[model samples]
Target: AQTVTQSQPEMSVQEAETVTLSCTYDTSENNYYLFWYKQPPSRQMILVIRQEAYKQQNATENRFSVNFQKAAKSFSLKISDSQLGDTAMYFCASARGNKLVFGAGTILRVKS
Candidate 1:
């Protein structure tokens, strides 16, 4: 069984600052995928970033980046220059086959 874990239940960042949300997972399968999904107050699950298990390089999209430590089974999301719009529930997910498992999620509140 693969389980995603986000130790931080809530986090807040000042506008234009940076914040990193920690995540770790336990999985037996070597081939899998990790993802970060953001759900705003509207409740839409939007994909933030993704990293394949076999890939050594971390993935980044605009102001979002990931610190993928395959050996430690850790995948963390870093948001640079955070904005009010970035405030949302960030969930860490793992996918294998057709199933996706998500963490409890961390509520990020960006203050202006």
Candidate 2:
């Protein structure tokens, strides 16, 4: 079984600053996929970034990036130059089959 863990329950960042959300997982499989999904107040899950276990380099999307530690089973998300629109509940997830296992989620509040 694969399980994702987000240590920080809540995070706050000032607009134009940077924030990093920590996440860790436990998995025995060698191949899998990790993802960070952001859900705003509207409750829409949006893909923030994704990283493949086989890939050595981290993934980046606009202001979002990931630090994937395969051996440690850790995958963290970094949001640079955070904006007000970035305020949302960030969830870390792992997917292998049709279903995805998600963490409890970290509430990110961006102050303008």
The global C-alpha lDDT for each of the candidates, from Candidate 1 onward, is: 0.96, 0.94
lDDT of 2 by residue, 1-112 (tens): 7788999999999999999999998877788999999999999999989999999999999999999989889999999999999999999999857678999999999998
Spell out the clash pairs found in candidate 1: none
Quote the positional error of residue 11 for candidate 2 in Å: 0.4
Task: Please report the TM-score between candidate 1 and the true structure.
Answer: 0.98
Which portions of model 2 show Cα errors greater than 4 Å? none
Give the per-residue lDDT digits (tens) of candidate 1, residues 41-105: 99999999999999999999999999999999999999999999999999999996779999999
Clashes of 1: 0
For every model shown, what is its TM-score relative to the native structure?
Answer: 0.98, 0.96
Span of ten consecutive residues with least summed lDDT in model 2: 93-102
